[model samples]
Target: MATQNEVIFRLARSSRSVPRARALAHAVLSSWGVSQGTLEAAELVLSELVTNALRVRVPSDRQVGVRIARSLEDGLLRLEVSDAGSGRPEVRVPEDDETGGRGLLLVEALAHRWGVEERTGGIGKTVWAELKAPDIVAEPVGREVAAVLVRPGQWVRVWGEWRAVRTVDTGPYAAGGLAVVLGLDDGSALRVNAAEPLTVWNGGSSSAREGGEDEPG
Candidate 1:
C-alpha cells in the first residue's frame, strides 16, 4: 500500500525562480514529516533540476514546471523539473578551476536515482530524481542503546518525525546531559534533549538503534 502526495509549481524562466521552487519543495516535504536529510537532498536536487531547466533556451511565455511527489509507503521522494527547451541535459566533467557545469553531478551525488523523460505533448523534457527516505527505527533494549553517541549528521526521531542533528550542545545548561539542535530543509531549527530516545544509524551498517532513553514522546 503506497501513500502518495504531490505538489506542483509553475515558475517563470528566471534564475530567481529556482530558489522559490526549492522553498516550495521544502515546505511541502516538511508538512509531510520527511526527515531533514532527505529534505535537504530533495531541495538541492530540485534546485539543480530547476536551474537546468531555466538555463535552457525556451520561449519567454513557456514556464518551467516543478513537481514534487512523495510515496510514503515506498519511502521515496520524486522530483521532476520540466521545461520547453529542446535539448536534454548531460553530465560533463568540469575542470577544477571552472565555476560551472556541475549541476548534474550534484544531482547524481544526492539523489538515489535520476533520469530524463520526454514530456507528453510538449516540446521539452522532464528531468526527474528520487531520494530515499532516512532510516529511523526503535531502540533495542539493554546493550545497543547504551553504546551509541548522538552526533551531528545523525538522524533522530523528534516529535514523531525523523530529523537530522545539525548541532549538539554539551554545556553546563545541559546538566551533564547533551542538547541537540535539528535543522529542517527550509533552514528552520529545532532543539531537543539528547537524552531522548532517538534512533541513530550505526555507521554504514545495516542496523539503527535508539541512542538515548526509551521511546520519546
Candidate 2:
C-alpha cells in the first residue's frame, strides 16, 4: 500500500484560479470517496481561503499555494491556501449598509475547524480549514483510496457515488507530521496529523468584528 497522501497545486495569482481550484478539489475529493455534505463544505472552505489569498497584494512572480490532505487521526480533510502577501486576516463586524465582508464568518460556521498561521518556509501566511471526513468502509465493487489498486481509467464507487479515475501520483511529505506527497498532481492524496486548532484569528464566542466579512466562497 503506497501511503503517500496529499495534493498540492501552485496556482497563478489570478481570479480565474479560484473556480479552477474548486473544481480540482471537487474532482479529487469525490474520487477519494468524500461524502457529499462534507465535500460541499470543503469546497466552500477552499474557495474562501483561495479567494482571500488572491486579494492579497504580492509580487507578480509569486504564486498562491494550495494543499489538500486528510488527517491521519480521524480522516479529517485539511484545506490550506498560502500566499506571499501582506496583512493578517481579521474577522470584523461589517457596516449595516455594507454590501460584503462575511468570509470568515461563514468559514467559522461551516468548517469543523479552521485557522491561520505564518507560512512555513514562505513569506506571508496560510489560512486553513479542516472538515470532518467520515471513514468509508471498503465495498467489494466500490473502492477506497488505496493509492495502489486505484489507477487512472478505473471506475470506482467513491464514498457513495461512482467516479472515474484521472491520474494518481505520489507526492511530498509535509513536515509537522503530515505524510504529504510533494508536487503530486490531482487524483493523488495523503494523510496528515490533525493540525493545530484555530489560533491566528479567534472564532470563539466573540470575533473581532463579530458581524463578519467577505462574500465568502
Candidate 3:
C-alpha cells in the first residue's frame, strides 16, 4: 500500500510530460530526504517509464498516469507509469546500431526489481520499478573516524572486528539511506546500515569497487 508520502500525477501524452514527471519525482524524493544516488536512479527510471507510456497508442483524451511512492519502512522507492495501451513491456537486447529499445534495458539494470501489472479498475497497465534506498552515513564529528568514508574496499569495524565493505545498496526505502554488505574473514557475510555510527579501520586496502557481492572474506 502507498503511504502518505506517495505522489501521483496525470501526464499528457507529449514529450514534455517526461521532464514534468521527472521533476515531480525529484521534488517528492528530495522532500523525503533521499540520497543523491537514489534521486538520480529514480529520475532516470521515471523518465524511461514515462517515455514508454507516451509511446503507446492511447486515445488523445486519455492521459498517462505516474505514481511515485516511498516505503521508508521497507527502504524502497517505487515508480509506476500507467497507460491505456494494452501491451506488456519486455526487456530487449538492442542491436549495436539501435538508438532505442534500450529503455527497459536501462530500467532493468538500474531497478532492484521491475514489472507490469493491470491498473486497478482501469483499462490498461502500470509499469513499475523499485529502487532500494541508499544508505547515507553522516560523518562523526570531532574524531579521526569522522574522516573515514565508507565505500567498497573500505575496512570498517563491525562487531569489534574489521570487515571489508563488500557492497553498498542505496535505493529508496533503505534505512539511513544505505546498506552495506560486509565480507567476513571466515567466508561468511553480514549486512548493516552504512549510516550506523561504527568505527572504521584503515586495515590495508583492496581494489574492490562498490556495487557487487564480494568473494568470501
Candidate 4:
C-alpha cells in the first residue's frame, strides 16, 4: 500500500553509534510494515555496513553517510554506508581464532545482493546491501559466488580442502575480480571465476590492511 522510497542520514563513525543506524532502519521500515524476518535481515545488514565503516574507515570530523532506499525496478530495499576512507571490503573466510572477518560474510549470506564501489570526488568507498520483501519468494541457494578484486602481483591464499588449494596473482594489474575462496572451517567455499591471479604476501598486523585485502583468496 505504501510507495517505495529512500532515506539518508549522516553520522559520526563510532562503535557506540552503530545502534543509531539500526534504530533508524527500524523506524523508517516500520511505516512499510515489513515483517519480523525482513526487519532482522535489514538490521543485520545495517550492522555489518556500519561496523565495517567504523572499523575500517578512519573517522574524521565529517560525518559518515548512511542511505536507505528502495529500487522500484526490483522492488528491493538497499542499505548503504559511505565513508571517507579509500579502502574496500572483502568477504573473507576467517580463521577460527580471528575476531573480525565474519561481518562481511554475514552480509553476503543475508542480503540478496551486496557490493562496494569507489565514491566520487573522495578517497572513500561505499558499501551496500539489498534485500527483497519478506513475502517475496526466496531464491535457491547454490554454489556461492564471490567476486574478489586483488591487486596485480599481490599474493592471496585460498583456504579449503587440501586438494583444492590455490594461489594466484593478477600480474601487472593491481586488481583481480571474481576470485574464489572457501571457508574451510565452515565447509563452505564459493566457486569464483578468477579473472586474475593473486599475489601472496606475508601475514601482517590485523589493522594494517585496508578494504577486501584482508580476505582469503
Candidate 5:
C-alpha cells in the first residue's frame, strides 16, 4: 500500500512534458530535504526514462505516470516513471565516439539501486531508483571506521582507518575526522571519519577533493 509521503504525477509521453515531470519530482523530493546532488541525479534518471518512453512508444493522448515514493523503513527514495508503451526497455551499445547506449549505465552509476517493473492492467514499464538518505558520515580512525567521500560532484563510499597530516590545520573535523581533500600536491594528507557523511545535496561550495574509496566497509 502507498503511504502519505508518496507523490505521483501523470503526464503526456512527449519531450515537452519532460521538464514538468522533473519539476514535480524536485518538489516531492524537497519535502524530504534530499540533497542537491541527489536531486540532480534524480532529474537525470527521470530524463532517461522519459526519453526512452518517447522514443520507443507511439504517441498517445493518455498521460504517462511518474511516481515518487519514500520508503519509511530505510529512508530510501523510490522513483517510478511509467509509460504506456508496449516494448521492453533495452540499452544498445554504441561504437566509436557514440553518444547513445550510456543512459542506463549512468543511471546505474548514480543511483544506489534501480530496476524495471511491468505495469498492471496495461502495457508499460516503470524504471525505478532507490537512493539511501545521506546520514552516515565517514570518520577517520574511529570506532565508526567507515567513510563516504564527495569528490568534484561525485559520491564515493569506503571504509578503513583514516589518518591525518602533521602540518595541515585540522579544524573541528579532526576531532570528528579529517575531510580529506584529493587531487592536490600540497604535500599533505589529512583523514577524517563520519563528519555527517558529507552531504552532497545542499552543500554549495566544494569542501575538498574527494579521496578514493580505499576499501569497502
Candidate 6:
C-alpha cells in the first residue's frame, strides 16, 4: 500500500531513442542513489528493452514508453518499457553463426527478476525488470521534481536530454541558500538547488570526464 513515485518518459518511435532512453535511465537512477554497478546494469537493461520494443512491428503512431519506479513494499527498483505490439518476447538461444538475438538474455542475467505483463490499456504488453536497488531513499513528496546544481565539465540531465555543463555561476558563496545557475552546451541556463535530486551523469566506466557520457557527439 505504499505510494509509488515514477519517472515516465515517452520516446518517439526511432532507433535513436534507444540511447536517449539509456541516458534518461542513468539520470533518474543516479539521482535515486543506486550503486555504480546497479546503474550500469540498469542502463544496459533499458537499452535492450527499448531496442526490442522498437523492433516490434507496431503501427507507426505507437510510441514507446519508459517507466522507472521503486517498489517500496520490497525495496526493489523496477524498470518498464511498453510497446503497442502483439505477442510475447522470449529469450531464445541464438545459433552459433548468428550475429544477434541476445538482448533479453542479457536482461535475464542482470535483473533480479523480470517478466512481461499485459498493459492496462488492453492493447500491448509491458516488459519489466526489477533489481535489488539498495540505498535509494524513500519516495519523495513530488514525483517529477528532481533538480540539482551541476558542476562545470560534468554531464547533467535537463529537459529530458543529457547535456554537458559548460559553466556554473554560483553567484556568491556568501549568500546562503541562493540558487546556482548552470550554463549548458545547448546555450540554455538552468537554476537549481545544490541538493540531492538532479543526477550527475557518470557512467562509471572510466576516469576521464570527457569520456564519461558521449557529449553531443
Please tell me which predicted candidate would have the highest TM-score against the true structure.
6
- Candidate 4, superposed: residue stretches over 4 Å from native: 1-4, 57-59, 134-217
Task: Give the TM-score (vs. native) of candidate 3.
Answer: 0.60
Tens digits of per-residue lDDT for model 5, 1-217: 1124554545554566566557556644655567788777887887777666667646666556667666556767777877776766655667879868778777787788988889977777777877775631222111221233333332222222111111222344655555554321223343555344432221122221122221001
Clashes of 6: 0
Report the lDDT tens digits of candidate 6 across residue range 62-107: 8787888886657688999999998999999999999999999999
lDDT of 1 at 185: 25
lDDT, candidate 6, equals 0.72
Error of 4 at 190 (Å): 51
Report residue 140 deviation for candidate 4 (angstroms): 33
Residue 142 displacement (Å), model 4: 40
Give the TM-score (vs. native) of candidate 6: 0.64
Runs off by more than 4 Å, candidate 6: 1-4, 139-217
Candidate 5 whole-model C-alpha lDDT, 0 to 1: 0.53
- Which ten-residue region of model 6 has the weakest summed lDDT? 205-214
Model 1, range 1-217, lDDT digits (tens) per residue?
1232555546666666766666566656765777788888888889889888878887876877777777656878789988888877899999999999999999999999999999998778999999997442222211122112566545444343333354555433255665555553224566555555554432221121123111111
Candidate 4 local Cα displacement, residue 61, angstroms: 1.2
Clashes of each: 1, 16, 16, 15, 18, 0
Error of 2 at 177 (Å): 40
Cα miss at 167, model 5 (Å)?
65
How close to the true structure is residue 39 of candidate 3, measured as C-alpha lDDT? 89
TM-score, one value per model: 0.60, 0.61, 0.60, 0.58, 0.56, 0.64
Best-performing candidate as measured by lDDT: 6
> Which consecutive 10 residues in model 2 have the weakest lDDT in total?
198-207
| Candidate 2 vs candidate 4, TM-score winner | 2
Q: Write the per-residue lDDT of candidate 2 for residues 98-164, one digit (tens) a residue.
A: 8767788778889888888998787898888888887622222222343443444443332322223
